[model samples]
Target: MGEDHMERLIEGHKRFLAEVFPGRKSQFHLLAETQAPEWLFITCSDSRVLPDLILGTGPGDLFITRNAGNVVPLTSQDVDGCTATIEYAVEVLRVKHAILCGHSDCGAMKAALDRAGLDALPKARRWLQHVEAAFAHRQPVNSAEGESAELASLIRGNVVAQLWNLKAQPSVVRAVDEGRLTVHGWYYDILSGRIEEYDEELRKFVVLGE
Candidate 1:
């Protein structure tokens, strides 16, 4: 099974080299040397959430960091991948915008909702503690979500929680205070194929582009 999956990935890479790479050879050449992405996209590791595909962005457009829950830990004492990536994107790369996106049916949020199988996964269990604040920030359940309404609310709440953590990063704080950075929270609904941006002024998630 593993070999079959590897073969499939190899075939995809071959197609990229044969078909896709040729048309964008110059783009690849410049990207190989250096990247000056303007957006810092922090999103979940869920395979369903493809930032480039949904946002119509390409390489060199976004500096991305992904984790199970799109978490940005607020610990100054501990050095973690997510926080370190944020520091680099803000202080070094000078990314102008940082977006924390959560998706519908996120496995991380589901696990946080129910600790049923968490005992078997120690590291994941510990990591999920960061999302505990989601319960407090839970948005009102939307009837349109049907059976998944409750879970969806929690997922959106997690986005808000993580967004706050992202803003609290020292580099991000400095950039924002200097008027060089703007942070946003987003919820991507897999079923609807749409994105909702959290409006700080309205304190609600509003549909993007509409």
Candidate 2:
């Protein structure tokens, strides 16, 4: 880490210690020993994204895994950190719900959609192969929202694609069959600060809480 970057993070930690930590000290102590997080949060690795800040979740409430496109590869035999964490969350932690969330204006999705631009980034181009399924899963684009809708629709499609991949994981498959778990797909629109949940039964996206 850069010295300047470390200094900024330390300064932020100081603020957290002074302002945010005191109010939640008692809760923090219990979490220090053990954590029984109930939710698994899967999202993109975006600088502006913070799950706890957006969802108002406390430290131990969520187990999170972030990646370039929040892509979950079903065919890979190689051990991926995201899959390993998800397996632990399902099998060990026994988390009851797993939320796969994708966001608007996602660089990954945009890159996946525009392949020619990524010709130079061989690794990233290869990594995004996981999202090819998103095109088939895309929601009917909303014309009213213009360009924003196109991106949001694609982002939501990624959530759907990844959720299916997540369900294909052995641990997650068994957990759901046992009725010990539920998987959710979410579209988080940063500009609007609105969260829409994918209704698996309805095959539609609806604003959270009706």
Candidate 3:
């Protein structure tokens, strides 16, 4: 079975080399030399949250970082993976927009909402501690999000929580202060395939397009 999967991957690579790569050879060649992505997208590792598909982006367009729950750790001494990546994107890549995007029905948020299954996963439990701050930032439940209102509220709150943490990074703070970076929090509904941006001024989630 594994061999069959490997064969399929090989076949796919061949298809890319033959059919896909040729049409975009120049684009790939430029990317081979260097990448100067403008948007730093921080999102969940959920298979459903395809940033490229949802944002209509392709290779070299976005500098992406992903982890369960889309977490940004809040420790001054500890250099977590998420923060390290943000520092690089800001200081080196010089990305202009840093977006923290969370999604509906996220397993990480579900795990956070219920600690029943937490014992089996020690690392995950510890990592989700970052989400505790989300409770304080929870947006009022939106009926539009349906029966999973509690979960959806927490998800939006997590986006806001992480967005602040992203801002707290020294590099991010400097970038923003120097007028080099902008930060955003976003909630994506997998069922409806719609995205909402958290309006910091209004303190509410609004349609991303609007």
Q: Give the winner by TM-score.
A: 1
Candidate 2, superposed: residue stretches over 4 Å from native: 1-5, 146-148
lDDT per model vs. reference: 0.92, 0.89, 0.92
* Deviating ranges (above 4 Å) for candidate 3: none
Query: For model 2, how does the per-residue alpha-carbon lDDT over 1-210 read when each residue is reduced to its tens digit?
Result: 499989999999999999999999999998999999999999999987789999999789999999999888877668888899999999999999999988878999999878998999998998899999998888865566535666768888888889899999999999999999999998887877888898888887889879
**Sliding window of 10 residues with minimal summed lDDT for model 1:** 140-149
> Local error of candidate 1 at 130, Å?
0.4
Which is superior by TM-score, 1 or 3?
A: 1
lDDT of 1 by residue, 90-133 (tens): 99999999999999999999999999879999999999999998
- Estimated TM-score for each candidate: 0.97, 0.93, 0.96
Candidate 3 weakest ten by summed lDDT: 140-149
- Model 3, 66-95: lDDT tens per residue? 999999988746777888899999999999
Residue pairs clashing in model 3 are none
State candidate 2's TM-score: 0.93
Clashing pairs in 1: none
